[model samples]
Target: MAIDWKGVFPAVTTKFGEDDQLDFPLFEKNLQFQLDAGVNGIILGGTLGESSVLSLEEKGTLVKFAVEKVAGKVPVILNIAEGATRDAIELARLAEEWGAKGLMMLPPMRYKSDHRETVEYFRATAKSTSLPIMIYNNPVDYKIEVTLEMFAELADLENIQAVKESTRDLTNVTRMRNLFGDRFKILCGVDTIAMEQLLMGADGWVAGLVCAFPAETVAIYKLTKTGRLAEALEIYRWFMPLLELDIHPKLVQYIKLAEERAGVGSEAVRAPRLTLIGEERERLISLIDGAIAKRPVLPEYHSIVV
Candidate 1:
Protein backbone atom coordinates (compact mmCIF):
# COMPACT_ATOMS: atom_id res chain seq x y z
CA MET A 1 0.00 0.00 0.00
CA ALA A 2 1.24 3.50 -0.89
CA ILE A 3 0.85 5.71 2.19
CA ASP A 4 -0.68 9.11 1.44
CA TRP A 5 1.42 10.58 4.26
CA LYS A 6 -1.20 13.23 4.91
CA GLY A 7 -3.76 13.65 7.76
CA VAL A 8 -3.96 12.67 11.44
CA PHE A 9 -1.92 9.54 12.30
CA PRO A 10 -2.18 8.69 16.00
CA ALA A 11 1.01 7.56 17.76
CA VAL A 12 -1.02 4.91 19.56
CA THR A 13 -0.34 3.64 23.08
CA THR A 14 0.68 0.01 23.68
CA LYS A 15 -1.73 -1.64 26.09
CA PHE A 16 -0.08 -4.13 28.44
CA GLY A 17 -1.36 -7.07 30.49
CA GLU A 18 -0.83 -7.60 34.24
CA ASP A 19 2.41 -9.44 33.51
CA ASP A 20 3.50 -6.55 31.25
CA GLN A 21 2.95 -8.59 28.13
CA LEU A 22 1.44 -7.13 24.94
CA ASP A 23 -2.25 -6.85 25.73
CA PHE A 24 -3.40 -7.72 22.24
CA PRO A 25 -7.16 -7.69 22.89
CA LEU A 26 -7.04 -4.37 24.74
CA PHE A 27 -4.63 -2.97 22.15
CA GLU A 28 -6.99 -3.90 19.31
CA LYS A 29 -9.85 -2.20 21.11
CA ASN A 30 -7.94 1.11 21.05
CA LEU A 31 -6.98 0.63 17.39
CA GLN A 32 -10.60 0.01 16.39
CA PHE A 33 -11.54 3.33 17.99
CA GLN A 34 -8.92 5.24 15.95
CA LEU A 35 -9.96 3.58 12.70
CA ASP A 36 -13.65 4.23 13.37
CA ALA A 37 -12.83 7.84 14.20
CA GLY A 38 -11.27 8.00 10.74
CA VAL A 39 -7.58 8.49 11.47
CA ASN A 40 -5.53 8.55 8.28
CA GLY A 41 -2.96 6.10 9.62
CA ILE A 42 -1.98 4.21 12.80
CA ILE A 43 1.58 4.46 14.21
CA LEU A 44 2.64 1.54 16.40
CA GLY A 45 5.36 1.77 19.12
CA GLY A 46 6.28 5.46 18.92
CA THR A 47 7.05 7.50 22.04
CA LEU A 48 3.40 7.57 23.07
CA GLY A 49 3.33 3.82 22.43
CA GLU A 50 6.36 3.21 24.71
CA SER A 51 8.57 1.70 22.01
CA SER A 52 11.67 1.91 24.23
CA VAL A 53 10.49 -0.67 26.77
CA LEU A 54 8.97 -3.15 24.33
CA SER A 55 10.95 -6.27 23.40
CA LEU A 56 11.48 -6.98 19.68
CA GLU A 57 9.07 -9.91 19.96
CA GLU A 58 6.41 -7.70 21.54
CA LYS A 59 6.83 -5.11 18.79
CA GLY A 60 6.62 -7.80 16.11
CA THR A 61 3.40 -9.07 17.64
CA LEU A 62 1.97 -5.53 17.62
CA VAL A 63 2.99 -4.94 13.99
CA LYS A 64 1.47 -8.20 12.80
CA PHE A 65 -1.73 -7.73 14.83
CA ALA A 66 -2.28 -4.12 13.80
CA VAL A 67 -1.52 -5.00 10.17
CA GLU A 68 -4.04 -7.81 10.29
CA LYS A 69 -6.70 -5.92 12.25
CA VAL A 70 -6.36 -2.68 10.30
CA ALA A 71 -6.47 -4.81 7.15
CA GLY A 72 -5.57 -1.88 4.91
CA LYS A 73 -8.27 0.51 6.14
CA VAL A 74 -5.25 2.75 6.63
CA PRO A 75 -1.54 2.07 6.58
CA VAL A 76 -0.01 0.55 9.73
CA ILE A 77 3.33 2.29 10.49
CA LEU A 78 5.91 0.97 12.98
CA ASN A 79 8.29 3.35 14.73
CA ILE A 80 12.09 2.76 14.58
CA ALA A 81 14.05 4.22 17.51
CA GLU A 82 17.03 1.90 17.65
CA GLY A 83 20.29 3.08 19.20
CA ALA A 84 22.48 2.08 16.25
CA THR A 85 22.20 2.54 12.50
CA ARG A 86 22.53 -1.22 11.92
CA ASP A 87 19.87 -2.00 14.49
CA ALA A 88 17.56 0.55 12.93
CA ILE A 89 18.17 -1.01 9.51
CA GLU A 90 17.53 -4.48 10.87
CA LEU A 91 14.27 -3.32 12.46
CA ALA A 92 13.24 -1.49 9.30
CA ARG A 93 13.58 -4.76 7.39
CA LEU A 94 11.67 -6.55 10.11
CA ALA A 95 8.89 -3.92 9.99
CA GLU A 96 8.48 -4.52 6.27
CA GLU A 97 8.43 -8.27 6.78
CA TRP A 98 5.86 -7.89 9.56
CA GLY A 99 3.46 -6.24 7.06
CA ALA A 100 3.93 -2.59 7.98
CA LYS A 101 3.21 -0.25 5.08
CA GLY A 102 5.63 2.49 6.25
CA LEU A 103 7.88 3.57 9.13
CA MET A 104 8.12 6.51 11.56
CA MET A 105 11.88 6.55 12.27
CA LEU A 106 13.82 8.50 14.88
CA PRO A 107 17.51 9.36 15.12
CA PRO A 108 19.92 7.28 17.21
CA MET A 109 18.73 6.80 20.77
CA ARG A 110 20.83 7.76 23.89
CA TYR A 111 23.76 9.13 21.85
CA LYS A 112 22.86 12.47 20.28
CA SER A 113 24.63 12.48 16.94
CA ASP A 114 25.90 15.59 15.21
CA HIS A 115 24.34 16.89 11.99
CA ARG A 116 26.53 14.81 9.65
CA GLU A 117 26.00 11.68 11.67
CA THR A 118 22.24 12.30 11.91
CA VAL A 119 22.01 12.63 8.16
CA GLU A 120 24.02 9.42 7.72
CA TYR A 121 21.77 7.55 10.18
CA PHE A 122 18.58 8.54 8.38
CA ARG A 123 20.09 7.86 4.98
CA ALA A 124 21.32 4.43 6.03
CA THR A 125 17.90 3.48 7.41
CA ALA A 126 16.25 4.75 4.25
CA LYS A 127 18.69 2.72 2.16
CA SER A 128 17.90 -0.44 4.05
CA THR A 129 14.13 -0.31 3.63
CA SER A 130 11.85 -0.10 0.65
CA LEU A 131 9.07 1.18 2.95
CA PRO A 132 8.54 4.96 3.04
CA ILE A 133 9.83 6.77 6.14
CA MET A 134 8.56 9.72 8.14
CA ILE A 135 11.51 11.27 10.00
CA TYR A 136 10.52 11.95 13.63
CA ASN A 137 12.15 15.40 14.21
CA ASN A 138 11.46 15.88 17.92
CA PRO A 139 14.39 17.87 19.26
CA VAL A 140 12.57 18.79 22.45
CA ASP A 141 12.43 15.32 24.04
CA TYR A 142 14.95 13.46 21.87
CA LYS A 143 17.69 16.21 22.12
CA ILE A 144 18.65 15.57 18.49
CA GLU A 145 17.20 18.15 16.14
CA VAL A 146 16.95 17.18 12.49
CA THR A 147 17.51 20.71 11.26
CA LEU A 148 16.90 21.93 7.72
CA GLU A 149 20.53 21.46 6.79
CA MET A 150 20.36 17.79 7.71
CA PHE A 151 17.15 17.49 5.68
CA ALA A 152 18.88 19.09 2.71
CA GLU A 153 21.49 16.35 2.86
CA LEU A 154 18.69 13.77 2.92
CA ALA A 155 16.62 15.36 0.13
CA ASP A 156 17.67 12.94 -2.56
CA LEU A 157 16.59 9.83 -0.67
CA GLU A 158 13.26 9.23 -2.41
CA ASN A 159 11.96 6.98 0.35
CA ILE A 160 12.72 9.56 3.08
CA GLN A 161 9.39 11.21 2.35
CA ALA A 162 7.96 13.00 5.40
CA VAL A 163 8.86 14.71 8.71
CA LYS A 164 7.01 14.71 12.05
CA GLU A 165 7.94 18.33 12.87
CA SER A 166 8.05 18.62 16.69
CA THR A 167 10.84 21.18 17.09
CA ARG A 168 8.32 23.41 19.03
CA ASP A 169 9.58 26.33 16.97
CA LEU A 170 6.40 27.40 15.15
CA THR A 171 8.43 29.36 12.63
CA ASN A 172 10.14 26.11 11.63
CA VAL A 173 6.90 25.17 9.91
CA THR A 174 7.17 28.22 7.66
CA ARG A 175 10.92 27.66 7.41
CA MET A 176 10.36 24.05 6.33
CA ARG A 177 7.73 25.05 3.79
CA ASN A 178 9.97 27.77 2.39
CA LEU A 179 13.14 25.66 2.41
CA PHE A 180 11.92 22.23 1.40
CA GLY A 181 8.74 23.20 -0.44
CA ASP A 182 7.19 19.85 -1.28
CA ARG A 183 10.44 17.93 -1.11
CA PHE A 184 9.13 16.42 2.13
CA LYS A 185 5.63 16.07 3.51
CA ILE A 186 5.30 17.80 6.92
CA LEU A 187 3.24 16.14 9.67
CA CYS A 188 2.77 18.37 12.73
CA GLY A 189 4.09 16.41 15.75
CA VAL A 190 3.22 18.51 18.77
CA ASP A 191 -0.31 18.24 20.12
CA THR A 192 -0.79 21.79 21.46
CA ILE A 193 0.72 23.40 18.35
CA ALA A 194 -1.09 21.10 15.91
CA MET A 195 -3.74 23.55 14.70
CA GLU A 196 -1.18 26.33 14.26
CA GLN A 197 1.12 24.05 12.29
CA LEU A 198 -1.75 22.97 10.05
CA LEU A 199 -2.59 26.64 9.48
CA MET A 200 1.10 27.04 8.61
CA GLY A 201 0.84 24.31 5.95
CA ALA A 202 1.62 21.00 7.64
CA ASP A 203 0.38 18.17 5.47
CA GLY A 204 -0.69 16.02 8.45
CA TRP A 205 -0.53 15.50 12.20
CA VAL A 206 1.47 12.77 14.01
CA ALA A 207 -0.68 13.15 17.09
CA GLY A 208 -0.13 12.08 20.73
CA LEU A 209 -3.23 12.94 22.71
CA VAL A 210 -5.35 11.80 19.81
CA CYS A 211 -4.88 8.28 21.15
CA ALA A 212 -7.40 9.33 23.79
CA PHE A 213 -9.45 11.98 21.99
CA PRO A 214 -9.67 10.73 18.44
CA ALA A 215 -12.91 12.49 17.53
CA GLU A 216 -11.82 15.85 18.89
CA THR A 217 -8.40 15.50 17.29
CA VAL A 218 -9.88 14.69 13.90
CA ALA A 219 -12.35 17.55 14.32
CA ILE A 220 -9.58 20.09 14.99
CA TYR A 221 -7.45 18.96 12.05
CA LYS A 222 -10.39 18.83 9.68
CA LEU A 223 -11.68 22.22 10.77
CA THR A 224 -8.25 23.89 10.52
CA LYS A 225 -7.34 22.42 7.15
CA THR A 226 -10.69 23.42 5.70
CA GLY A 227 -10.29 27.09 6.80
CA ARG A 228 -12.78 26.89 9.64
CA LEU A 229 -10.49 28.56 12.16
CA ALA A 230 -13.27 29.76 14.42
CA GLU A 231 -14.73 26.29 14.72
CA ALA A 232 -11.29 24.75 15.05
CA LEU A 233 -10.35 27.19 17.78
CA GLU A 234 -13.54 26.45 19.68
CA ILE A 235 -12.59 22.78 19.85
CA TYR A 236 -8.92 23.67 20.33
CA ARG A 237 -9.76 25.91 23.28
CA TRP A 238 -11.65 23.06 24.95
CA PHE A 239 -8.88 20.60 24.07
CA MET A 240 -5.88 22.81 24.96
CA PRO A 241 -5.61 21.88 28.66
CA LEU A 242 -5.64 18.14 27.92
CA LEU A 243 -3.42 18.62 24.88
CA GLU A 244 -0.82 20.19 27.18
CA LEU A 245 -0.41 16.77 28.79
CA ASP A 246 1.29 15.43 25.67
CA ILE A 247 4.38 17.57 26.35
CA HIS A 248 4.87 16.40 29.91
CA PRO A 249 7.61 13.97 31.02
CA LYS A 250 5.04 11.29 31.84
CA LEU A 251 2.90 11.76 28.71
CA VAL A 252 2.28 8.04 28.26
CA GLN A 253 0.74 7.65 31.70
CA TYR A 254 -1.11 10.95 31.31
CA ILE A 255 -2.54 10.02 27.93
CA LYS A 256 -3.51 6.57 29.10
CA LEU A 257 -5.34 8.14 32.01
CA ALA A 258 -7.17 10.34 29.52
CA GLU A 259 -7.90 7.20 27.49
CA GLU A 260 -9.55 5.52 30.47
CA ARG A 261 -11.53 8.68 31.17
CA ALA A 262 -12.59 8.72 27.54
CA GLY A 263 -13.64 5.04 27.99
CA VAL A 264 -11.14 3.66 25.47
CA GLY A 265 -8.36 1.84 27.36
CA SER A 266 -6.62 1.16 30.69
CA GLU A 267 -4.19 3.41 32.52
CA ALA A 268 -1.92 0.41 33.14
CA VAL A 269 1.69 1.40 32.43
CA ARG A 270 4.75 -0.88 32.52
CA ALA A 271 7.15 -1.25 35.44
CA PRO A 272 9.22 1.81 36.43
CA ARG A 273 6.23 3.85 35.15
CA LEU A 274 3.18 3.57 37.33
CA THR A 275 -0.23 5.16 36.71
CA LEU A 276 -0.63 8.72 37.98
CA ILE A 277 -0.84 9.02 41.75
CA GLY A 278 -1.25 11.64 44.55
CA GLU A 279 -1.56 15.25 43.43
CA GLU A 280 -0.29 14.36 39.97
CA ARG A 281 -3.14 11.90 39.51
CA GLU A 282 -5.69 14.41 40.74
CA ARG A 283 -4.22 17.11 38.51
CA LEU A 284 -4.57 14.99 35.35
CA ILE A 285 -8.00 13.76 36.35
CA SER A 286 -9.04 17.36 36.91
CA LEU A 287 -7.98 18.29 33.38
CA ILE A 288 -9.72 15.35 31.73
CA ASP A 289 -12.82 15.74 33.86
CA GLY A 290 -13.06 19.49 33.27
CA ALA A 291 -12.77 18.97 29.53
CA ILE A 292 -15.39 16.25 29.47
CA ALA A 293 -17.80 18.31 31.52
CA LYS A 294 -17.83 21.05 28.89
CA ARG A 295 -16.90 19.03 25.85
CA PRO A 296 -18.09 20.49 22.63
CA VAL A 297 -20.54 18.76 20.33
CA LEU A 298 -18.00 18.34 17.55
CA PRO A 299 -18.91 19.25 14.02
CA GLU A 300 -19.12 16.56 11.38
CA TYR A 301 -15.60 15.26 10.69
CA HIS A 302 -14.87 12.47 8.27
CA SER A 303 -11.31 11.56 7.36
CA ILE A 304 -9.96 13.50 4.40
CA VAL A 305 -8.78 10.46 2.54
CA VAL A 306 -6.15 11.74 0.13
Candidate 2:
Protein backbone atom coordinates (compact mmCIF):
# COMPACT_ATOMS: atom_id res chain seq x y z
CA MET A 1 0.00 0.00 0.00
CA ALA A 2 1.33 3.47 -0.86
CA ILE A 3 1.62 5.74 2.19
CA ASP A 4 1.43 9.55 2.03
CA TRP A 5 4.51 10.26 4.12
CA LYS A 6 4.49 13.98 3.55
CA GLY A 7 3.78 17.02 5.79
CA VAL A 8 4.36 17.32 9.59
CA PHE A 9 3.89 14.39 12.00
CA PRO A 10 4.70 15.14 15.62
CA ALA A 11 6.06 12.56 18.03
CA VAL A 12 3.09 13.63 20.20
CA THR A 13 3.66 14.04 23.92
CA THR A 14 2.10 11.53 26.36
CA LYS A 15 0.67 13.78 29.02
CA PHE A 16 0.84 12.79 32.70
CA GLY A 17 -1.02 13.90 35.82
CA GLU A 18 0.34 15.06 39.18
CA ASP A 19 0.31 11.45 40.37
CA ASP A 20 2.70 10.66 37.51
CA GLN A 21 0.17 8.48 35.78
CA LEU A 22 -0.95 8.73 32.17
CA ASP A 23 -3.47 11.54 31.80
CA PHE A 24 -5.62 10.15 29.02
CA PRO A 25 -7.90 13.20 28.90
CA LEU A 26 -5.01 15.64 28.67
CA PHE A 27 -3.32 13.36 26.17
CA GLU A 28 -6.47 13.35 24.05
CA LYS A 29 -6.74 17.09 24.38
CA ASN A 30 -3.14 17.43 23.20
CA LEU A 31 -3.87 15.23 20.19
CA GLN A 32 -6.91 17.35 19.37
CA PHE A 33 -4.73 20.47 19.57
CA GLN A 34 -2.43 19.07 16.86
CA LEU A 35 -5.26 17.90 14.62
CA ASP A 36 -7.01 21.25 15.01
CA ALA A 37 -3.84 22.91 13.79
CA GLY A 38 -3.89 20.71 10.62
CA VAL A 39 -1.10 18.20 11.25
CA ASN A 40 -0.85 15.46 8.62
CA GLY A 41 -0.45 12.74 11.27
CA ILE A 42 0.32 11.87 14.87
CA ILE A 43 3.20 9.68 16.12
CA LEU A 44 2.52 8.00 19.46
CA GLY A 45 4.84 6.22 21.96
CA GLY A 46 8.09 7.54 20.43
CA THR A 47 11.12 8.86 22.35
CA LEU A 48 9.30 12.11 23.02
CA GLY A 49 6.34 10.15 24.37
CA GLU A 50 8.51 8.36 26.99
CA SER A 51 7.88 4.99 25.36
CA SER A 52 10.67 3.29 27.26
CA VAL A 53 9.10 4.13 30.60
CA LEU A 54 5.65 2.80 29.69
CA SER A 55 4.62 -0.77 30.47
CA LEU A 56 3.18 -3.10 27.81
CA GLU A 57 -0.37 -2.53 28.99
CA GLU A 58 0.19 1.22 29.19
CA LYS A 59 1.64 1.32 25.70
CA GLY A 60 -1.33 -0.59 24.37
CA THR A 61 -3.73 1.75 26.10
CA LEU A 62 -1.93 4.81 24.74
CA VAL A 63 -1.93 3.55 21.15
CA LYS A 64 -5.56 2.48 21.34
CA PHE A 65 -6.55 5.80 22.81
CA ALA A 66 -4.74 7.70 20.09
CA VAL A 67 -6.41 5.66 17.34
CA GLU A 68 -9.88 6.23 18.76
CA LYS A 69 -9.29 9.93 19.35
CA VAL A 70 -7.92 10.48 15.89
CA ALA A 71 -10.97 8.53 14.60
CA GLY A 72 -9.60 8.10 11.06
CA LYS A 73 -9.00 11.82 10.75
CA VAL A 74 -5.21 11.37 10.69
CA PRO A 75 -2.60 8.67 10.45
CA VAL A 76 -1.23 7.38 13.76
CA ILE A 77 2.25 5.83 13.81
CA LEU A 78 3.16 3.89 16.95
CA ASN A 79 6.75 3.53 18.09
CA ILE A 80 7.48 -0.12 18.84
CA ALA A 81 10.92 -0.24 20.41
CA GLU A 82 11.85 -2.29 23.44
CA GLY A 83 14.80 -4.12 25.00
CA ALA A 84 13.65 -7.40 23.43
CA THR A 85 12.56 -8.16 19.89
CA ARG A 86 9.65 -10.29 21.11
CA ASP A 87 8.31 -7.38 23.15
CA ALA A 88 8.70 -5.02 20.22
CA ILE A 89 6.87 -7.41 17.92
CA GLU A 90 4.11 -7.80 20.49
CA LEU A 91 3.67 -4.03 20.58
CA ALA A 92 3.68 -3.84 16.78
CA ARG A 93 0.95 -6.47 16.55
CA LEU A 94 -1.09 -4.68 19.18
CA ALA A 95 -0.66 -1.35 17.45
CA GLU A 96 -1.86 -2.77 14.15
CA GLU A 97 -4.85 -4.46 15.78
CA TRP A 98 -5.72 -1.26 17.60
CA GLY A 99 -5.81 0.66 14.28
CA ALA A 100 -2.50 2.47 14.11
CA LYS A 101 -1.79 3.64 10.56
CA GLY A 102 1.88 2.55 10.67
CA LEU A 103 4.80 1.51 12.87
CA MET A 104 8.22 3.01 13.68
CA MET A 105 10.87 0.62 15.01
CA LEU A 106 14.32 1.32 16.41
CA PRO A 107 17.19 -1.10 17.02
CA PRO A 108 17.03 -2.91 20.37
CA MET A 109 18.92 -0.97 22.99
CA ARG A 110 20.40 -2.18 26.36
CA TYR A 111 22.58 -4.92 24.80
CA LYS A 112 25.04 -3.77 22.15
CA SER A 113 25.47 -6.15 19.21
CA ASP A 114 26.81 -6.50 15.66
CA HIS A 115 25.35 -5.34 12.31
CA ARG A 116 23.90 -8.81 11.68
CA GLU A 117 21.89 -8.60 14.89
CA THR A 118 20.57 -5.16 14.03
CA VAL A 119 19.48 -6.34 10.59
CA GLU A 120 17.78 -9.38 12.08
CA TYR A 121 15.93 -7.28 14.64
CA PHE A 122 14.37 -5.09 11.94
CA ARG A 123 13.78 -7.99 9.56
CA ALA A 124 11.89 -9.88 12.24
CA THR A 125 9.76 -6.80 12.91
CA ALA A 126 8.98 -6.40 9.20
CA LYS A 127 7.94 -10.04 8.97
CA SER A 128 5.67 -9.74 12.01
CA THR A 129 3.72 -6.64 11.00
CA SER A 130 1.74 -5.98 7.81
CA LEU A 131 1.62 -2.27 8.69
CA PRO A 132 4.02 0.06 6.88
CA ILE A 133 7.24 0.23 8.93
CA MET A 134 9.58 3.17 9.21
CA ILE A 135 13.12 2.46 10.42
CA TYR A 136 13.94 4.98 13.18
CA ASN A 137 17.70 5.53 12.83
CA ASN A 138 18.94 7.15 16.03
CA PRO A 139 22.36 5.69 16.78
CA VAL A 140 23.06 8.21 19.50
CA ASP A 141 20.16 7.02 21.66
CA TYR A 142 20.15 3.30 20.82
CA LYS A 143 23.93 2.75 20.54
CA ILE A 144 23.21 0.82 17.36
CA GLU A 145 24.10 2.48 14.06
CA VAL A 146 22.39 0.85 11.06
CA THR A 147 24.81 1.10 8.14
CA LEU A 148 23.48 2.24 4.76
CA GLU A 149 24.02 -1.25 3.32
CA MET A 150 21.85 -2.70 6.07
CA PHE A 151 19.13 -0.14 5.36
CA ALA A 152 19.29 -1.02 1.63
CA GLU A 153 18.88 -4.69 2.48
CA LEU A 154 15.90 -3.97 4.75
CA ALA A 155 14.37 -1.72 2.11
CA ASP A 156 13.73 -4.86 0.08
CA LEU A 157 11.00 -5.84 2.55
CA GLU A 158 7.61 -4.75 1.23
CA ASN A 159 6.39 -3.54 4.61
CA ILE A 160 9.51 -1.48 5.25
CA GLN A 161 8.22 1.65 3.53
CA ALA A 162 10.11 4.58 5.09
CA VAL A 163 12.98 5.69 7.34
CA LYS A 164 13.10 8.38 10.03
CA GLU A 165 16.66 9.55 9.34
CA SER A 166 18.09 10.81 12.67
CA THR A 167 21.75 10.30 11.81
CA ARG A 168 23.01 13.90 11.58
CA ASP A 169 25.17 13.10 8.54
CA LEU A 170 24.18 15.04 5.43
CA THR A 171 26.27 12.70 3.29
CA ASN A 172 24.30 9.69 4.55
CA VAL A 173 21.00 11.52 3.90
CA THR A 174 22.09 12.23 0.31
CA ARG A 175 23.26 8.66 -0.16
CA MET A 176 19.99 7.24 1.22
CA ARG A 177 18.01 9.42 -1.17
CA ASN A 178 20.18 8.18 -4.07
CA LEU A 179 19.91 4.53 -3.08
CA PHE A 180 16.29 4.34 -2.04
CA GLY A 181 15.01 7.21 -4.21
CA ASP A 182 11.20 7.07 -4.24
CA ARG A 183 11.12 3.39 -3.33
CA PHE A 184 11.46 4.14 0.39
CA LYS A 185 10.40 7.47 1.86
CA ILE A 186 12.92 9.39 4.01
CA LEU A 187 11.46 11.52 6.83
CA CYS A 188 13.61 13.94 8.80
CA GLY A 189 13.86 12.93 12.49
CA VAL A 190 16.09 15.72 13.62
CA ASP A 191 14.13 18.96 14.01
CA THR A 192 17.13 21.30 13.62
CA ILE A 193 18.09 19.86 10.23
CA ALA A 194 14.51 19.35 8.93
CA MET A 195 14.66 22.19 6.39
CA GLU A 196 18.04 21.00 5.11
CA GLN A 197 16.79 17.40 4.87
CA LEU A 198 13.59 18.37 3.04
CA LEU A 199 15.55 20.56 0.60
CA MET A 200 17.95 17.66 0.12
CA GLY A 201 15.01 15.42 -0.96
CA ALA A 202 13.50 13.99 2.24
CA ASP A 203 9.87 12.95 1.91
CA GLY A 204 8.62 14.54 5.17
CA TRP A 205 9.45 15.06 8.84
CA VAL A 206 8.75 13.17 12.10
CA ALA A 207 9.38 16.09 14.37
CA GLY A 208 9.17 16.46 18.17
CA LEU A 209 8.59 20.20 18.10
CA VAL A 210 5.52 19.55 16.00
CA CYS A 211 3.88 18.39 19.22
CA ALA A 212 3.77 22.01 20.32
CA PHE A 213 4.06 23.83 16.98
CA PRO A 214 2.42 21.85 14.16
CA ALA A 215 1.39 24.83 12.04
CA GLU A 216 4.91 26.26 11.94
CA THR A 217 6.36 22.83 11.16
CA VAL A 218 3.85 22.31 8.36
CA ALA A 219 4.51 25.83 7.08
CA ILE A 220 8.23 25.12 7.03
CA TYR A 221 7.67 21.99 4.95
CA LYS A 222 5.30 23.77 2.53
CA LEU A 223 7.68 26.71 2.14
CA THR A 224 10.63 24.46 1.39
CA LYS A 225 8.63 22.21 -0.93
CA THR A 226 7.79 25.19 -3.17
CA GLY A 227 11.46 26.28 -3.42
CA ARG A 228 11.00 29.38 -1.27
CA LEU A 229 14.51 29.09 0.09
CA ALA A 230 14.78 32.63 1.38
CA GLU A 231 11.54 32.51 3.39
CA ALA A 232 12.25 28.98 4.61
CA LEU A 233 15.75 29.96 5.70
CA GLU A 234 14.43 32.93 7.65
CA ILE A 235 11.94 30.72 9.50
CA TYR A 236 14.70 28.15 10.04
CA ARG A 237 16.90 30.75 11.69
CA TRP A 238 14.09 31.75 14.10
CA PHE A 239 13.18 28.12 14.81
CA MET A 240 16.73 26.74 15.07
CA PRO A 241 17.24 27.58 18.74
CA LEU A 242 14.05 25.76 19.78
CA LEU A 243 15.08 22.76 17.68
CA GLU A 244 18.51 22.75 19.32
CA LEU A 245 16.84 21.68 22.60
CA ASP A 246 16.58 18.13 21.27
CA ILE A 247 20.39 17.77 21.40
CA HIS A 248 20.29 17.83 25.20
CA PRO A 249 20.15 14.57 27.15
CA LYS A 250 17.00 15.79 28.93
CA LEU A 251 15.12 16.38 25.70
CA VAL A 252 11.78 15.06 26.95
CA GLN A 253 11.87 17.55 29.80
CA TYR A 254 12.87 20.38 27.49
CA ILE A 255 10.08 19.57 25.02
CA LYS A 256 7.38 19.23 27.69
CA LEU A 257 8.51 22.49 29.24
CA ALA A 258 8.20 24.19 25.88
CA GLU A 259 4.67 22.77 25.56
CA GLU A 260 3.71 23.86 29.06
CA ARG A 261 5.08 27.37 28.59
CA ALA A 262 3.24 27.62 25.31
CA GLY A 263 -0.04 26.25 26.87
CA VAL A 264 -0.08 23.33 24.42
CA GLY A 265 0.45 20.51 26.98
CA SER A 266 1.35 19.76 30.54
CA GLU A 267 4.90 19.85 31.87
CA ALA A 268 4.29 16.55 33.64
CA VAL A 269 6.53 13.61 32.66
CA ARG A 270 6.73 10.04 33.96
CA ALA A 271 9.41 9.10 36.46
CA PRO A 272 12.87 7.92 35.23
CA ARG A 273 12.02 11.15 33.35
CA LEU A 274 11.55 14.26 35.48
CA THR A 275 10.40 17.84 34.93
CA LEU A 276 13.11 20.49 34.49
CA ILE A 277 13.93 22.49 37.61
CA GLY A 278 16.05 25.40 38.90
CA GLU A 279 18.62 27.02 36.60
CA GLU A 280 18.17 24.61 33.71
CA ARG A 281 14.39 25.06 33.63
CA GLU A 282 14.73 28.83 33.83
CA ARG A 283 17.26 28.88 31.03
CA LEU A 284 15.01 26.85 28.70
CA ILE A 285 12.02 29.03 29.50
CA SER A 286 14.00 32.22 28.87
CA LEU A 287 15.30 30.95 25.55
CA ILE A 288 11.81 29.95 24.33
CA ASP A 289 10.31 33.24 25.51
CA GLY A 290 12.92 35.09 23.52
CA ALA A 291 12.23 32.98 20.41
CA ILE A 292 8.52 33.67 20.72
CA ALA A 293 9.20 37.37 21.05
CA LYS A 294 11.57 37.72 18.09
CA ARG A 295 9.89 35.35 15.62
CA PRO A 296 7.29 36.84 13.31
CA VAL A 297 3.69 35.77 13.87
CA LEU A 298 2.72 32.81 11.71
CA PRO A 299 -0.63 32.42 9.91
CA GLU A 300 -3.93 31.68 11.72
CA TYR A 301 -3.56 27.97 12.35
CA HIS A 302 0.22 28.42 12.49
CA SER A 303 0.13 30.46 15.70
CA ILE A 304 2.02 28.83 18.62
CA VAL A 305 1.08 29.46 22.23
CA VAL A 306 3.64 31.46 24.23
| TM-score top scorer | 1
Q: Tens digit of lDDT per residue, candidate 1, span 187-274?
A: 9999989999999899999998898889999988888888888999999998999999999999999999999999888899987888
Worst 10 residues of 2 by lDDT: 297-306
What lDDT would candidate 1 get against the real structure?
0.91
Backbone clashes for every candidate come to 0, 0
Tens digits of per-residue lDDT for model 2, 1-306: 235877778998888899888898888878888888778788888889898788878877888888888888888898877778897788788888887889888888788868898899999988998898888988877778888889877877999888898988867778987777788788899998899899888878899877776667877887787776777777788888999887788888898888887777888988877788899889999998888778666644344221
Task: Output candidate 1 Cα RMSD.
Answer: 1.2
List candidate 2 segments past 4 Å from native. 299-306
Local distance difference test values of all predictions, in order: 0.91, 0.83
Deviation from native of the Cα of residue 282 in model 2, angstroms: 1.2
Q: How much is the lDDT of residue 142 in candidate 2? A: 79
